[model samples]
Target: ANHGLAGAEFLAGIPGTVGGALAMNAGCHGGETWGIVERVLMLDRNGALRERTAADFEIGYRHVGLRDAADECFAAAWFRLPAGETAASRRRIRDLLEKRIASQPLQWPNAGSVFRNPPDDHAARLIEAAGLKGLQIGGAHVSEKHANFIVNPERRATAADIEALIERVQTRVREAFGIELVREVRIVGDKA
Candidate 1:
């Protein structure tokens, strides 16, 4: 944004690295990471580097995966951002950041939005409508400020606590509205 590149202003509001953004096709404020991608450098587990374009992968809202189902990670990317006024891009980034600060539980430990918004509806709204706000499991709770967020205010919530709370939220919302909430944040671990 400082260099007058347009279209990447949404990245300012995202919390993770470019690699994570690419992996998930992360987006906010109407622009997604994959939307500006020209080409990408990928490294497979066997250490072979390959260059691929958008056609080589499937991209969608908060999701990206190799077309061939290759086990690889994004090593780097070349973006194709259009030229724009530096001041305007900076202002856009600032506005997005401000909006995030106001609506998200930034002061507490969180993994951003827990669930992907269902078609034509928001996860936060559904969670709130289900009376799940401030719902707790151990030290983790659905944030009162933003129902989509599970906050660990004192940093005392274990992985099990957070996972349990997520399941509870899913159960209640499904029972009440019959819409199954799909998680945005990926959980990876062996169950004990």
Candidate 2:
């Protein structure tokens, strides 16, 4: 891992930028991004960069500070990770990648996990148990391989398709298990 960061290895195979990851507190395999962060560099609308430490900003699961409506954007991050053996680090990275492939729907165009794990239970388990696997709305389908993933098979699924499927899944899970599914995939923009 760069800068001898212990947790950076856990992010192997994750497709996204550091800014996005930091904003979401992105993690997998029990390693969160903020856990290794020492300092953050933010840019404002005027292109001025400001340095802020971890304590200067609020940190939580998939949350970051707003700087009180300052409209700052993440520019860079400095990680504070400990050194470790090179070979062991590489192996651990490979292992985590394998784990991700086996459990995630990586073959399709999808935006990672659609819902967060609720408490002591996994969202996939809940969805699969509800008999929602292989369900599709338009071209977007809940992955037969992993219920938590909504895949755009054939790359023909529109935003509406994905959004509709997400809503359906949420409704069904709520009705069946009495648990409201909170979306983890951030949605932006309006229907064109």
Collision pairs in model 2 = none
lDDT of 1 at 21: 90
Candidate 1 lDDT, 1-192, residue by residue in tens: 777789898888677788989998888888889999999999989999999999999899889989899999999999999999999988888898999999999999998988999999999999999999999999899999999999999899999999999999999999999999999888877741
Identify the runs in model 2 with alpha carbons over 4 angstroms from their true place.
2-5, 67-69
lDDT of candidate 2 over 13-73, digit per residue (tens): 8767898888877888888898988889999899999998877667776677764667888
Query: TM-scores for all candidates?
Result: 0.96, 0.92
Model 1 local distance difference test score: 0.92
